[model samples]
Target: MSLLLAAPILIPLTAAVLCVLAWRHRTLQRGISIAGAAGLLASAVALFQQVSASGPVASQMGNWPAPFGITLVADTLACIMLLINGFLAVCIVLFSLGGIGQRREAGGYHALVHGMLAAVSGAFVTGDIFNLYVWFEVMLMASFVLMTLGGQRGQLEGATKYVTLSLISSMLFLSGVGVLYAVTGTLNMADLAVKFAAVENSALAVSLGLLFFVSFGIKAAVFPMFFWLPASYQTPPPVIAALFAGLLSKVGIYAIIRTFTLIFSHEPQMVYTIMLAVSGLTMVIGVFGAAVQTEIRRILAFHSVSQIGYMLMGLAVTGAAVADGLPGGSVAAGASASASTSAVNAAIPEFAVMALAGTVLFLVHHAIVKTNLFLVGGIVLKLRGTTVLARLGDLYLTRPWLAVLFMVTAMSLAGVPVATGFWAKLVLVRAGLAGGEWIIVAAALGTGVLTLYSMTKIWSEAFWKVTPDAADLAAAGQHPTDEAIDAADIGPRGVPIMMTVVAVMAVATVALGVLAGPCYRVAERAARELLEPQAYIRAVLGPTAGRPASASEPAPAAASAGGVPSQR
Candidate 1:
């Protein structure tokens, strides 16, 4: 348990600190980074073991009890998230060996990566709401530096938009936190869970919840707030882009789920309805955006937003189902008074379970698969020395393995069967039908098909077509600017073998589909834990942890799913 808590946060922080202390020694910095990443992986595995045995572990910082001080909690979900993130860090570190080494100031890049890892891990483990905010800032700061690491014109331009939007989002989030603290007078999550119950249906609480929703929505790239992502994410180096794709947006989703289930569960109808509406629009807009993009990374970036919509759909239905009532029990007892009992009986229609499972499974699978795609793209650009669809050509003959890998990744993105993507969409669609939400079900299916279309467009343009064979391209009459052709020479080409190895490992990510059943069962248990939260509360506040520090009664579990009707 100690290793689980310490390794993810400390291993990375220690490495970053060491690198800073030995900034002049590039070799030493590399050694520290690799060792730290390796230790982080070991710690993740160890944490998984502890979670498997103990259910969940909570460590109060400095040995103070949960509500009074800070605590780091690791549940099955947290452990699994850590494992995926650790694996990504390891692969990206390996990928960075040659690329980051070429840069003049490697120390800062390496240090920032480590710091970013620590921040991400901290966000996952921390039990205090304010702590989550701290970690968000840390991670964003690292991302800004990494995005601009190349010091190129495009990167600087993109980073400017990225930082501006991210800063604004952070300010919004901080302001939300201030309002929440002002209302509840507690920042610790479990402690607030208790306090929030007392104020469940209050206008103040609902308003605060919306503030967080907007703030996290921006970070998560959900719908209206997603404009900044496609513009900035495409400009970073492959390793950094892959890291951002795999982990950064997830933190936003995690925050939403955590707050919805624990704090805002009081208002299921309003929250879930809004989520459903936004999700539908997000899917439509994101895929439509992808349809128009010719750039490889930009298309993938749009798909990220689309996929987030799918993940949220399940939760919206889950909230609706839970609101409809638990299977046969005293409504009052089942309310806030017996949260654990109600949670167990919630019976999230098999489809909902399947959908939620797929969502989590997809999150893990997408992280690996997406990273692999970016790395493979990097390799293609390396050999051809160009990423532009109009200028680049003939990678199929030059790098067969890379071409094949790209095909598999693109197909998986298209949600073809036997791939992890198939199962994700399948479950999501099934859940919508089970909830009698036929329109949502149809929307999800349409998104999958559109996803396929977008993917195939990229495949045909970048891989299948013969480039430089175009009459217009070679014609002297065309007199196309020489600068367009010279832009291809801006970077190195020739896919390195190490990168190819990194890309190939995505096959394992696909294999998770074969093992989906057990994973789903595990996800169910985790979901149950999330919904009940008694164990979490006990872990944080202790059996005798008593009431919230504030003077409000536990919000009554309203008979309806809109979390206990707003306490008047």
Candidate 2:
């Protein structure tokens, strides 16, 4: 069980190590990268299966019990995320083989990618908030390097913005952890939940919650904090941009979802109100930003920000079920009433589950679809030598398969009927409406309309538009686009390696749409676990996990003598 739990992290870490050792041999590094990603996907699937068969699972280090040792856990949510993270790593690795170029490859590109993967896996599985922060740092460092791999002027400019914002977020997160640990004296999330809830300092609790919210909000790139994403994501290599598109902000969203659901859930109304507002603005602003962009990758980069808004809406559009109490074991533990506000927070949100399911499904859909878009953009860049829309046209007539692949993901991104995007939007809209969140529903519907516009912009500029010939370029006073890059092959195996990736992902996007039922069900089940986290708590901290320690019980010296201590 422990091996299974560690496999996802270990495989990627080992791959990174081997990549470093074989840095001189790009072939060996590439081989190891592919193998590691495959192993990660395998471990993720096995973990998901084990969790399906036997509920949430936890593994402690050094044979130590919960609340003491470093712990790795896999609830349904974590399993699903693990699977997505691993799946994308494979796709990105394969795609990078062609596009990442020899300069970056020899500059530790494969090793850094694997390092980022390992950190992401760590973040998903770690049961400790402090460890979550640690993993975030690892992810940040690896991404910072990946962002600036080639030392291009554009890469450096983007890396500056990315690292600057990222460091601020990390600082805030570490501060939140410091405050949380100072107050509760435990960094274990499960134990921190119970202990933090038992604290009587309302000011401290609410303030800390908001502090953490701001920290994660910045990372998640909500509304006002989203400017850095478009600036940075579009600057990297297409494959790297696609990887960032697919996974980076979603990890931030993952952190937000996990923290809000399990730890600071007592006062959800504050988060609810704030998230709805942020989500709406994020959606509109991001789409508007994308609408005005002519660069294919820049437009997709802006769409990534918009998509983050959609994911955050899941948590925003919870329920009138808040009136009934029972949000996160808060009310039952007599901590249900809002400590910050007088609004009743007895939450048993029916729509919350559905909304969250929409989030998970969309996360998967957007990761595949959005990344596929960037990958396709890379195809254009390689074929035409530029991603600027005005220079290129008539891909549909020339590269029909590429056209089809673009449409596959583009339609999905637009939320067209029968695509995964449609169902994801439908579920979220329904959930918001059911919860009486008219603003969220409107933002969702309105955003979809604008999302369609963005996709159409890309379709027209990048594909359907007729080719601008050399004569046309000179007539229009433009540079040569297809001069040296006319249908040119990419990668060691040429176009096949790159095409295979887009083809595979396009198929997966359709499969997820056509078979959205099981995926949604699993996501919904995970939502239930998140809303009612006792099973998760118990799985990590034994049977007594969610239960608050009584003053009558004997105190433990470690974890501030107020934690749910080791029983054996």
Return the top candidate by lDDT. Answer: 2
Q: How far out, in Å, is residue 319 in model 2?
A: 6.9
Residue 494 C-alpha lDDT in model 2: 52
Candidate 2 lDDT over 1-568, as tens digits, reads 8889988899999999999999799899989999999999999999999999988888776666667777788899899889989999999999887877777788999999999999999999999999999999999999999998878777788889988999999999999999998888778787776676677665676688778878888888888998899988877778888888888887898998888777876653555677788888999899889989988888998889998888888877752245235444333334552232222312465677898888888788888889899999887877667888878799888888999988878888989877789899999899888888888788888888888888888888888998777787678776433211223344234566788999999898888888988888998889888877777777776764454452112332233222234321
Displacement of the residue 426 alpha carbon in candidate 1, Å: 1.6
Give me the runs in candidate 2 sitting further than 4 Å from their true place.
319-333, 337-347, 471-493, 548-568
Instruction: Write down the lDDT of every candidate, Cα atoms only.
Output: 0.72, 0.80
Candidate 1 least-lDDT 10 residues: 559-568
User: Tens-digit lDDT track for model 1 on 437-468?
Assistant: 78777888898899989877766777777777
- Candidate 2, TM-score vs. the true structure? 0.92
